[model samples]
Target: MKKPTPYTVSARLYDLISFEWPVYGAGRSTAISLLDLAPGSHVLDMGCGTGLNFPLLQRQIGPRGSITGVDASAQMLAQARQRADSAGWSNVTLIEADATAVNPAALTPHQRFDAAIATYALSLMPTWQTALLTMISATRPGGQIAVVDMRTPTGAAAVWTPLARLACRLGRSDIEAHPWSDMPQRLARVRSASVRGGHIQIRVGSVGRDGDSVPERDAALDPPRQR
Candidate 1:
């Protein structure tokens, strides 16, 4: 058997050690709020990690909607499955696969998702660019995608740099990876918000018909088309 890493060592204790309430939770909440998903809408929670975002996402998606959460860690998925089972959320689906390599078509066999979000997960993937492109490809045209991840603090908040670096090191995340910066080029109506003294960045954008953005007339008239 493989030795456990930070994520796999204690999946059950992740929520407590993750600093959700004071630090990372704010980014997840803010990012999900910006998704603007409607009830019954299908959403994807990339790197769902112990289902930490499930309850918040469920509030927006409701019982009728579904969530497909993908992660590479089996132990983490086990914990996530437990959370879903305890909550009696039949709508939640957990997949054990690498987000960087998993084929979206296999995950969403019938239809693409209405919205997708990745919270504090991308910075850990070396191929985060491919992971993000897969997310965009998995959503329907005009659907929303949100990326929430961290970076070193700015301005006066730079005082927190050492602490931030230490946290990232402990979590096995790249503190310098600005994965959210690529959103504008791939999607339209891109918008962003920063919090925690600029350490966390939230970016939400609508998938464009052409990936460069459809003309207003085309956007109004055309039906969903695969990218």
Candidate 2:
């Protein structure tokens, strides 16, 4: 029998209990702002969960842009579908597949995305590096790729480490994963930000035409306000 993923069992109650508004939302918002997407762009939201990033993405991509959301949990995808439907967004597509193993070509045949983002999602997969590489593969050259994930709080915020670990444990994520650490080495012109006392890390970078480094200046965005 297949093991039940954390999201499969908690999809319905996720939004309410996942501490979205209070904690994690800032990371997604900060990452999207760095994406600098234009209208009519096609984006990939890997491990989309319940599509909490949908509204923010829609605001940037507008009605013309399309969103391809991939998640392993059918229940989570169902919620994401409902979110799109309720908002009357026809451009959102939800696919059930593992981010670590999904074929990029299957995601969008004959075309690549304008941008691909995985917000607070990668750490859940033990093979997060593979998933991040897949995200890079799925994006077009000169396109944007962003990742937002969590870690233990830092400095005075270290007091919250236990609570942060608890949250990560519940979500089946590794608080020590530090998935975004690999971004600078993989992508070009990498931009970064942190929020919630560094518990959340955001990285955005551009893909070179050769699928290597793009020769552009790297700058880090000012950290978003901690809540």
Candidate 3:
């Protein structure tokens, strides 16, 4: 039998206990702003726990746009479904699968997305690099890919390191994962932001054209087509 994860066990209490407004929310908001999504754009949300990014994404994409959210935990996906239904967001699609291993074609059958994002979720996966590569492949050429994750607080915020570490540990995330580190190498025109005393890190970048090579391991994962 598969082991139950914290996400599965805490799906119901996630929003109230996740420290969204006080600490982590800034990171997601900043990444979405950097994406500069146009109205009607299609977006893929990897590791989209409980659809927390839905409200912000919907505001940018409007009613005509669509969101495909993927998560490994069925319990979490259930919560995400409820959130979408309550908001009456008919354009949201939720899928249950491991972000690192799921095929992009399975997420969007007709076309690649205009943008892809993962917020505070990648560090939990041991194969976060594969997840990052998947995000790049799921987007169209020149489309945006954003990753928002956690790390130890820096500078004056270093004083809060213990608390930050505690938060990440409780969530079963690795503060040292630094999943966004590869964004600069894989994507073009990379942009970044740090918030919550440096505990939150955000990176947004654009997918390269056809001649541009994605990492070798990702080559078999349905690389994005050139425009």
Candidate 4:
């Protein structure tokens, strides 16, 4: 099994040290806003480390809606569970599993989710595209699918390129993996945004009905792929 070392070993310190408010938070906030989620909408959060997106998501989803958060790190899920409990959010569900291997039908007996979001998570997986495909399949047709990831800074932000690369390296992410690049081909009504010196990239789009089937390839690799 591939260990999520940063999350597993330092899950508790993640919220404090992850640069949520000053930097990475911008990407999640922007992605959630673009989701255009409706009240009572069921949502899936793939690779939902420490449930950082829960607060913003709950604001829009409300008590009537539900959130299913999945992560590979058990330590991370523990933190997420505590966050939900402390917030008194009974609608939240946290699962320990690889995003690529989770079975949508087994997640909930209810219909497919109204939307799904993955933030700062996909680039860490070698099979990031496969994880994205799973998110699309778990969501209802026409449901929104949003992805937020990172890359080296560009343009006027070029000065921060080294810092950006260093961050990705520490987090065990593929800084060169432009996972969001798949949005145009796999989705509709595609929209995008960038922040943090253009190091963060966000992609949001609607999943078509035909994309709701799991790919034929194996979801769980014998030796989990790495960057």
The candidate that achieves the highest TM-score relative to the unseen native structure: 2
Q: List the lowest-lDDT window of 10 residues for candidate 1.
A: 218-227
- Candidate 2, superposed: residue stretches over 4 Å from native: 214-217, 224-226
Q: State the number of backbone clashes in model 3.
A: 0
Model 3 pairs in collision: none
**lDDT for each residue of candidate 4 in 1-227, tens digit (9 for 90 to 100):** 67654577889998987878878988888889878799999999999999999999999999999999999999999999999999999999888888777777777576889999999999988888888988888888889999999988888889988888887888888999999988777887677777776788888888876864322221211111111
Model 2, residue pairs in steric clash: none
Residues 1-227, candidate 1, lDDT per residue (tens digit)? 75464588868788888878878888887788778789999998898889988999899889999999998888999999999999999999998888899998977899999998999889999999988988998999989999999999999889999998998888898988999878877888777777788888888888997644542321221112111
What Cα-based lDDT does every candidate model obtain?
0.85, 0.90, 0.86, 0.84
Count of backbone collisions in candidate 2: 0
How many backbone collisions does model 1 have?
0
Question: All candidates' TM-scores?
Answer: 0.91, 0.96, 0.92, 0.90
Best by lDDT: 2
Point out the worst 10-residue segment of candidate 3 by lDDT: 218-227
What lDDT does candidate 4 reach at residue 63? 100
Candidates sorted by TM-score, best first = 2, 3, 1, 4
